[model samples]
Target: MGFDEVIPAPGRAWWSPVDQGAFVLDPGTVLHAGPGTERVAHWLRSTVGAATGLLLAEGRGDHGIELGLDPGLGPEAYRLDVTGQGIRVRGGDPAGVFWGAQTLRQLLGPEAFRRAPVDPGRREWPVPLGTVEDRPRFRWRGLMLDVARHFMPKDGVLRYLDLMAAHKLNVLHLHLTDDQGWRIEIRKYPRLTETGSWRSRTKFGHRASPLWEEKPHGGHYTQDDIREIVAYAAERHITVVPEIDIPGHSQAAIAAYPELGNTDVIDTASLTVWDTWGISPNVLAPTDNTLRFYEGVFEELLELFPSEFVHVGGDECPKEQWRQSPVAQARIKELGLADEDGLQAWFIAHFDKWLSARGRRLIGWDEILEGGLAKGAAVSSWRGYAGGIAAARAGHDVVMCPEQHVYLDHRQAPGEDEPVPIGYVRTLEDVYRFEPVPPELTEPEARHVLGTQANVWTEVMEDPARVDYQVFPRLSAFAEVAWSHLPAPREREFIGFQRRMVAHYARLDALGVAYRPHTGPRPWQRRPGVLGRPLEGPPPNR
Candidate 1:
């Protein structure tokens, strides 16, 4: 295999056996700095120390390790050259350099991911002889964390960020608000968390047999928590994109502030935090007050996340309330809009204008394309690539997260029971075969396809371990799909990629990730309703 030590296979790389020779890292190794690489050096030292319990010394030297800047390499690209004498890594920017360091850790073997002190007999980590010239194929390699459905703590979020960075994934799209809960702290809206972040009980069990987790469930990240998470992600060159879902998933918010909902049609005073799943008819009323309330929320969001695009959830919005509300109908007539879809479009357009004024672009679910798409709105195509193809054709940016192929919440296999079983089966190969830009899009239209990401909706997932089980291995394949450019569907091969996973899994083990094994689920994991059926043909929703 050509330079087999890396995942998201490098673009250009070569490796050869050097007859019992390797770059052995030990306590005596010296880290030489390049401009803007002090942090990089420190990271390397900390990582090495964590794995081997030996701190590496830093100074100017002929070489132990060297980090250099190479402006010509372009952005998010790097070159790692390993020789018998030492190792040298060059990147176009700090992000590129950080990726290289992550790769270097992989090269050092699985033990490199461990935090345990070094063994008495093992004092060094060896990297094979090789050079890797690498860069990502797509700019928006990302993963979505749905903290709204079932809140994940700040620590878990940070851990997942580390894993994303290890795979060189650049974006962390945090689904922070939904009918189930609102997960971000807004100073002006304390009630949003105090009342909305919690639900009386949870709807659990299969569709045929329903049950409830009678205990109250809730959690929210404070402003300070968000600030720390953002900084941590920034240090690893990962951008945390916060999604404060609105319009449809606003039941929680409406529960906190009754005025935010359609009090004219729905009983706002009786609106409790949504206790179940699926689309909620309790959407944000298309009114000035609701608009002003969200603007204040976005003010806090924009300050927290430096991401250029903010996701305003515009999907699964039931029009029952809109169809019954006089205010919504009046807004549609006032704007000369067609129907409920038009009214929803008008609502999104308001935010589009609002966000644009603040130098940010509006991003929302593909449903935003319903009546009319905003001028600069970006679409996250979850239902399928059809929306993405349409959005690209319409000259708008698109992030292809088709539910069929990229939804990590889906069961890994047809018969395997899962902790959080939902959605149709999406195999590792299915994810590996996913290409962000659809074949139907022309070159010009394809330019609008920024890239793609996998989403982990946590309706059934109750803990970090469950999230780990649902997202991994498949996440690994997806990393390659987003970062490495292989041939089209039938032509692309994954055997080598599979081979590399053998070692990568060890790295994950060291990191204490509870990934599912390739052999399939353990016996305890198998159950009737828990095991999802395979998606043989196009899924009904898709």
Candidate 2:
């Protein structure tokens, strides 16, 4: 494949023909590492070498692949030059060199993505002579994976990290908690996992569906498991942002400890881990005890995740509970809050200040903007661009992931064949055309647009395969949207992108991704009789 065919399309590239003779990676090929590139050298030796079955011994021999750093390039920019003589990969920093290494692997063919070489005895791996100078359009190219609705084991999460790295995506927002389940262990709150992790049954499809799976479902990552996940992602230059939904989507936590809920408004002790989808009215009580309880949870959480930004879910919270509870009313009156919205904002503000005090920043859903945004909070604008625009203009950072464009759980096509089709139909091309920075923002305001993220909500996705079917192919498009410098949404050259996907499909297959084929889902991939919540009209962007 030529450089033009690379996914997320390189910023600039020049390729030579096969007749010029391909540079072969033989048994004798050595790997040379320069200053500040030890990590990349190790990654090349371990990851690429393991996949290609080459020793790639450490040395400075002639015709060896060299990895080095260039002080002039951007931190995430890299330059690759390959010829019959040898290959040179250089970047401004370690991350750039690592991304360059990813491109090198891509050049070696689909087999380079495998865990082990298909032909163990074969040593020669040829790559065409070419030069690529590339850098990302956005620093925070991310994917938010919701594992609360349906748990993915640690290994699956690792696989996704690898996938994200392959596409030059650098952020993994792990939604660890929600109304349905809690997927992270807190030592201070042992029962969160013991009682809140498992649900008695699960909604088969949408919350409105009549079907139910009458079986237990739950899982949580141990502290060591989380440490491993963080280290694994760090190796690939990816950040794992942990999301702990607060105030709202805390039924699981409340189920673990009834005191965390509004006892006056509801029978908190009688509640169980949520068995269905959609918003839950069982929000946390706006009390000092609730604050202290979550503060303890965050104290342990900060130890596990060291990312600069911590997500406190500030979305879809119901006010009916606070409206009905005298305790909540007293708290609101005591704090001089306007109403329940102000209370929700106050809840988020507490954490924002708490996190800021510990040298970390707070990020939450756009709903956090309703009452009064905290001083040091970022917005994950999921509903649409309006929140993002407002946040940016107000000098707050924003990650545009409007549901109309990047919600992967939404059906890929308009048909019953799509598995548990949810929300709007957002096809692959639609994602490719998604522009993160809105035109309404002035140049200065646009700087607050940190980057873009594609959300994968697992409410209807029961297992990894179903998640794969919904995410991939379209994720490829979203990756380009985040990384590549492209024209306006309507002017993007999707036909060219489709051509590039032809080669990427082979790579996905080699990596064991059960992505929905471009034409449509494979017969086995379809959920025949499952119900879905498909809206009648198209999204505004469409």
Candidate 3:
């Protein structure tokens, strides 16, 4: 592989030809980690060492790999120098060291991504002599995984964490709750899992499809599972941002605790965990008891996820129930809220203050901007860039996750063979060319653009393999968009990206990722007849 072949392309890199010789890793080579870099060293030994059949035991030998910290570099910046003498990795911080290690694995070739050495008899692994200096272009390179719609087991979530790290993505926004199911165990609310985690059946494809997966479908992560996930991600320098839908997309929560719903408006007790897709009208009532219950849930959540931002899904919440309920109407009047929109805002603002007081920040979907947002609140602009632009201009931090661009669950191609396609056709190139920070924003406004994230909504993704098919390749491109400082979106060289992908694909293969091939889905990857809701007009730009 050439020195320039790094994905999420490094800031700068150069290499000497093979005629100059290369650094070779064999059973004799050791790993030496300086202060503050023990974690990264351990990871390299456990992951790369196992893959290459090298011991990489702790030592300070002349032919050893050295890990050190350089405070002068950017927090996520790293410098890697590989020569015949040895390999040296220095980072601004532990996270930077870890990222450099990821690049090192890439340099070692695809075989380094495997679980175990492919050829036990072959002992040496050669890394071309080179110098690579790199850092992320954005702080919040993220992937929002919706585990609620089609419950992914604990191991599946862990697997995704590894995948995110592989692409230099640092945030795992775990959408833990939605109308279809709740995937986190709340000890105070045991029924959330017992009653709300499963559905009687699931709509096989799009809601329009006349298909059904006529079997129970649901599972949740126990509190211990959550702790493990958070700890594991922290080891990789990835934060697990847990999302709990509020007001809307919360039928499952209401299903478990009828008292949390607007009981006066509907027999909320009659609601089971929603078995189908789409926003649900059974929203949480705007009552003190409802607030108290979620507060308890958040209290436990905070103990598990120490991430700075808590994502309270404030998008697509239908207000019909709030409009019809006498109790909701009286509460609105009592609070002097002008309308249901104001009530929704009031609910979000309450949590904003609550979370802020506890030294955490609140982040929600763009709808949280409807009435007004607290000064500390951030926005996940999913509808389009308009929300992100508005939020950024208003001095609110923004994560540009506009569905039109980075919705990985959308079909990669317009071909009929694509599996359960949804939304606009966002091919790999579309993602590679996606520009998260809109040019319209002023410099100050653009600073609020925390970064970008690709959201994988699982309405159509039924299993881990399906999730993999939708996320890879495009996610690889998205990673570049998030990490690299490339030319303008239109000017990005897709042809060069395709060339780099030739290597990345082999890495993905070694990692056992079931990604959609560049040539389109393989036979089994296609779902011939399953219907999809494909938009027909020009793709939305805002």
Candidate 4:
């Protein structure tokens, strides 16, 4: 038998398999067992029944059934061996089990399992044997959800987690704070939720218009809620990395606590959200009281999240406030800083050290690359690939989430058909063609490329349906890019993957997902019908 014949099994097994009769399965054939053995066994029976007349045994084998687990590896290793009287699976993690199941499905063939060889590779049939080792190239393949702009309910978060788990992604970066809203609840500061959580009026569409509805819009996640979410992710082996934008996108917090602002001026009467984002005069105070306020907030966060990485947003902090404020000027003078950028660096260094002491590594947007890069800081390159390149060259671990390729909020094509302002046009083909690690780096420098991420900024994604529409197919493209390695873009292989996506879309529909339709050419639909039709219109919204 060739490598194409076997299927991998799914789920974690504590006991190592005895090398009596084991064979490597095709990487694509596994099926995830999910959570436990009961579920795994149930899926195995049903899936086998559907594909072949074969049915799995109800319980652990009388012949001392055993499976092994390698936590350091990914889910693709599940392997199943069929011979003489019984079948046995090697490796028991849900992912491993799932992959094994996929191989089994393939072995069962397009017809029912009634045709399955009772003794595969007997005197007449040949069984292929080989050793296989597999692992992910990137450690932090992730997706960032900007829920602060538009709150997604708890159920929505779980659904997103399901997708993340299915794709073998490891991290879910929750953008919890922004100028629009403060999404996480702090018991000490009830006003942060009660007042700053909602806005009286919201800006509708890209065009600035007073088409305002009086409905208040906003919500926050309670500590209990976060605990539930964290546990849910852990079971799926996905880490939930929380991002609290500091110093810069802090208008909502300022609204809740006016004392944190530089000036005593209050803006309670302002009903609309801030139109402009970059540097604002009103930033977090650099005073001892301000530091204490943030420390209390982070203390609460540290308790809720168990992830080793915490994102302290150090992007888009303008130097205008530091230049104007007497206190900021005095701090700069006292600290003997060079300029406002130095002050910004000082703020980040402060948090970087603080987070380090608490057993957490600080991850910042690429802007932290400016002024001075902090030691032991991980960089998320969102502005472009240049930032990621810079970080990698400078000896920092980098997650390549360039707005050009990984920003899921951006439109997939150029047209009025898109949901948000077009920033970068990225088709499915374009996404499939992306390489997270830049070729410019040497082998050692390239090793610094941690992984990649798809960011969904919900500013224009007001509804969950729109959210799904933007995320789906593109996310699938990114999933393969993150998990599987291939030579440069092969149009045929990608098209085959797209055919599989059609089936995936049906599954998503059954699950009540509102994904965007795939209107491009099918993977198998290659005739010399059309060539090079240039896409036109605005870029995608990120």
TM-scores for every predicted model: 0.96, 0.97, 0.98, 0.78
What do the candidate models score in CA lDDT, each in turn?
Answer: 0.84, 0.90, 0.90, 0.66
C-alpha lDDT (0 to 100) for residue 33 of candidate 1: 74
- For candidate 1, write residues 1-542 as lDDT tens digits: 12675888889887766455678777777888799977888888777667776667776565488998898998989999988888999999988888888888888777778766647467776777789999888899999999998889999999998899889999999999999999999999899999999999987633322567789999999999999999999988898888887788889999999999999996898999998777677889889998889999999999999999999988888899989989888888888988898888888888999999999999998999998887799999998889999999999999999998998878787643555445677878888888888889999999999989899888767678778888988999999989887889667787777888888888888888988887886454433444344435433332
Instruction: Tell me the spans in candidate 3 whose CA falls farther than 4 Å from its real position.
Output: 525-529, 537-542
Give the per-residue lDDT digits (tens) of candidate 2, residues 1-542. Answer: 56767997888998887567778898899999999899889988888898999989988766789999996988799999998888999998899999999888888889888889899989798888889999999999999999999999999999999999999999999999998999999998899999999999997877667778999999999999999999999999999999999989999999999999999988999999999887888999988999999999999989989899999998888899899999989989999988989999999999999999999999999999999887679999988899999999898999999998899988888867676766788888889989999999999999999999999989888888988999998999999989889989888899999999999999999999999999987675434346554656532221
What's the candidate order when arranged by decreasing lDDT?
A: 3, 2, 1, 4
- Per-residue lDDT of candidate 4, residues 467-539 (tens digit): 8878877887787788666456644266656766655555455446667678842222211311122234323
Using TM-score as the yardstick, the better of models 1 and 3 is 3
Q: What is the Cα-based lDDT of residue 181 in candidate 1?
A: 96
lDDT of 3 by residue, 184-234 (tens): 989998999999999999988776677777899999999999999999999
lDDT of 4: 0.66
Question: Which stretches of candidate 1 lie above 4 Å from their native place?
Answer: 18-20, 118-121, 206-208, 419-421, 525-542
User: At residue 460, what lDDT does model 1 achieve?
Assistant: 68
RMSD of each: 2.1, 1.9, 1.8, 8.5
